[model samples]
Target: MATIALPRPVPRYRSSSPIPTLTHSINLDGINTSAACPIPIPNKHLPVCPPGPAPSDKPDTPPASPPTKHLKLQPQSLLYPPTNYKKVTHNSSAVYLIDAAGVAAAVNHISQQPLPEAGQVFPWLHGLHPANHVQQAFFVARRKALRKTPECYRGVTIVKADGNLSCSRLKSAVTTDEFMQTAMAEFKDIDPREGFSVRNFQIQSAKTAMLSDIIVYGEDADEVLRVGSDIAKAQRSRRQGLKALGHEVPVYHTFVCTSHFEEFEEHHPEIVVLDTRGELTGNVLDFFHQERVEMATMTKASEIARNVWLGPTDDLSMSGPSPDDEPFDLFIECSDLGRANVPALKNIVRELDSGAETSQYVEFPSSGSIMPPSWPLTEADDIVESCKWIYNLANGIRPSEDEGEITDIEGDSPMSSPIETRTSRPRKILIYCTDGYTESSMLALAYYMYAHGVTVSEAWLQMHIDKRRNFFAYPSDVALLNSIAPSILSNSPALAHTAPQDVTQRIHDEPAWLALMDGSLPSRILDYMYLGNLGHANNPDLLRAMGIGQLLSVGETAAWTAADIAAWGDENVCVVQGVQDNGVDPLTNEFDRCLAFISMSPYPPSTPSTKLTPPPFRPRPPQWHINPSPLPRRRLAQRHNLHRRSNARAVPLLPTRILLRARAPPQRHHPAASALQLRAAEVGGDDAGEARGAGEEGVGMGRDCERDCGDE
Candidate 1:
């Protein structure tokens, strides 16, 4: 309620006289202000005196000495919490009062009457006076909030009183011109391309069990535009995200949290922030503590970051493929069957030295070195020993790998130093020995990776292209190399004792089977549409990618499920229709079942396949699988009619009935025609061929064959 200014220091002059002292009006709590007088500064020659309330001249009182040269006073409230200053009110009187009676009797007797009651303030009196009681304000400006128990505070800020601090949500966090200018400056460094058109941004929050897809609005325009995101199992997300991004013009910079953000990289401005373990600290906080306290709070702070832009100036422009690249693929021939290893390697070396694209070539176990065993045994560092040889062949640098002297290859031309660079590491590897499908495919995969800085999946794909046929990598071998890829790349000595964990995976799924089937039969054009069983045709995951629906597979007793049909569409994928076929087959005793499943039923199919454009090549499926064979031409004619009834764009119809291939006969022998006719047995072993010929001759002609063949 009041402000007081303290007097400043002034130089004193030597004098023979005493100087009058400064004083103040007295205000008190049960204190006599009349006796409270100022202590005067005395001459150095004056004798020291005993300290008392004040100097007394009355004869009734003994002569009093001066106060101490130094002044010291302590307030009662600082050492105690219950004694803090409080506002006075009529409801409750003061509990205690200050006693200024010591000053009343000694100083000039302005208040000779006994000091007022113990619970009330005394009236003010003029003269030098000391405060009977000291006080402090409820609000502190340049002082601590709570001095006694600082332990109650932690972070940089604390809320002592809860007041109405009103704030409403803003679409953008940044409003001031200063903030935008600084953001633009950062953006300029991030993306030099001008014309600041990008607007929206996506911030992906990691999902937890308790909460998912939770979005919080921020004031800054950049933050408000953000949408949270996903993990790598985002096949569905990628497709949906691609479609969503393409609808609007390029106006937003979306931040997706997924790893495979290849879909967003093409046209839109994309910012990807991968989550790291550094985001959270693994510490425990036991108590609340002030941040500025001597012990300092032990709480961990949150980590955050944003990527303004990621340009391609360094990835390809700075470091890329080259002819003299150091790491190159090496192929070690390990034949499954007995063969001359030395002679075979020598032959390969000769072919390479004659006219290879690069001079960085060396055959394992060089020209004169002895060859090792084919099968690696347990405990003898079997496959491991061979691995070291392969490692040396690839890096050309001895990185303190275990068994050092052995790390040095005893070859006629040991690759001591690798060439500076290599343009393509995977392509450089070509392993062959009698048959390419044996034990070497996986080994070739490992070498391919070392030669080409790529992952196991990439290596497999590269090897697949290299052979353009069957390339078998053992599940065990594949697991071994993949596990050690990091160690090999890091050049760690840990690889020496490392063995493959029981983590190898089998080669399953498409195309792998396609290659294995190709060795005997040369390539044949078969439609990607396959039949034979419902299981193959109705895979939801597979169908979704191809955009092929399951309308033909409908009926309550239908083999496919709703998921199967919806796979080609979104999860809510639906179609409406009504029809049922009751017509019976004239040729067979069965009813005509497929009539309701007509082409262009209910809804149109969204698949990209056209009736004119042939589907992808399916090679061929075997005999027992080709179903109700056409030995009798009558059945073949029926197949021709079924093909005509439906629109040809349907993929399910092409699989089982269409596949046709044979090896024993010069021309193909239809499956049904493979049965024998009994009459030709007397003609001896050649009689079997005659019987087959007779069966083929008995086939009936389909009324529609000529028309279908013409279109084909």
Candidate 2:
């Protein structure tokens, strides 16, 4: 592993661009009411109460009412009602903060055509905000629709949803390095420097998704009302023509809340209501019932709200709890719940048991044998417990006496005798969250580990590379998963017959260094060995901690004095200096010496040392043994690159540019665990970065760094 030393208190990487400013004002009918009725930001003592627009001048329009009370609004809810036509337009998919009147204006403008009998209309509230009861209740009555088709070319789908491109931490742009420093600082018990590079690299390497917003109404006043009217006119003509021929038309889904149920009932008297008020359990059932819901993709929406209301700071540290603190877990059947409204989901298992004829419907069961209703999977303990629970449930273990089989029902039907005639259905577990990206990934990885009986690194590669789903898993989360993976995989049903002592002893005997790495590897690649550059060969303390009694260096010599060599033993340490790695150095000639040196024991000559010889490198499945190939330099480089690619394919997030043959493992005493176990030693230097290897395909005698700077 190559090591680069970095100076303490890392250099500042914040951008120097001018900060964007947001202004709030009040508009009363046609009059400017900013001075008289200024909006106040939410405080710790008071709920967010954005001022309503001034009473409309029109005779048919009712006067404005006082803002709602008992609302738990975000600090960013200093919004004012949109006064003009431009305020209530929907041009983009980006979520905007709007009041009930604004929503009505947009929907009314879009609904130029009369509705067909089969046409469905629903409003989807996008972002988190305070539940203004009056506004949410109004969407229940609207029967408007707009149809805008997205254009696709090549493989890219160009969404027409309105809003400017934005960042999650956009209020003040913070570099990935600064963010990692702050994030790593929180786990003070662990060495912040450890895995800092990998975590930084992970975030830097990921492509940030699209996040847009509608902060102010007055900013984009010149777009004229074409967004709503033109879309509405086209939809109106299409609906009329379709209705004439009794053809099926597109359904309308608008963003809305269930705030004012009475007003909704009054407006739509023909529709009967079953349940108006339900417990706010903060699950999918309460999606519309929520007074406040934030889009998981738009993290900066909340941050902007906080900056506008609470105040802004230059520090890059994350405020409050970790991202996706409120976990919403779902264990659904793929056949059932395939992207449908929660309300429409029915119990298919029960229906099948009763022999009831029904249309295709999916089921989403929770709160019993399935899993918990809510789990903030930030803590490692919580994650492990949840994973174990899922394991039991999936394996037909009723976790509690009160809980029953997931498919179990109370009564046996007369059709039960004919159940053998029905086709068997394959059951699948689908772990999902509100946004389908942020909060569910940890649980997904955990489930993968138990189901696949592989390391967390393998699970991660399969999910991101094979599944191709973008998920947000913090380094800390990955570390936690790695540390618990051995235990979790041991519980696999495949090992049910294995002796308890064998499994327990393996787990108990796992090297301390294994926890610090991101991937699982043996304690020793070969001999009392580690693969590193001169930097590592010189760090006596690091060598001692890693339990390395011998060192073999190629091309570069270690900075060891005679005294140092005497301390370590001249026989234990060997360096072939003055050999350049620029594709000309004959590494094959030195392999015998290197192998012989590696064969030497750290103990005195009296101690028994295994007779070591270079093993031929061969690619094999399940477990591939990497050894020095006796081939020439060019052929050896090609073979090593192939090996590196194969190993790197198992974990895509790892540094792929370079492949290292050997790495240092973490000690048992250190509680830190990462997805990979490699080490790069960094000496203090301003220009310190990843150590470079001068060879074709970036293969070097010294491998890439996999430092285990994990916390205790």
Please provide TM-scores, in order, for all candidate models, with all chains considered together. Answer: 0.21, 0.24
Candidate 1 at residue 291, lDDT?
13
Count residue pairs with overlapping backbones in model 1: 20
Candidate 1, poorest ten consecutive residues by summed lDDT? 678-687
Winning model by lDDT: 2
Predicted candidate 1 versus true structure: per-residue lDDT over 585-699, tens digit per residue: 1212111322212212222333321112121122222211111111112111111121121111112222111111111111111101101100000000000121111111111
Error of 2 at 152 (Å): 40
Candidate 2 TM-score over all chains jointly: 0.24
Query: lDDT of each structure?
Result: 0.23, 0.30
Residue 314 displacement in candidate 2 (angstroms):
33
- lDDT, candidate 1, equals 0.23
Clashes of each: 20, 41
lDDT (tens digit, per residue) of candidate 2 on 454-520: 4555454444333333333333445556566666767644445557677556556544433433221
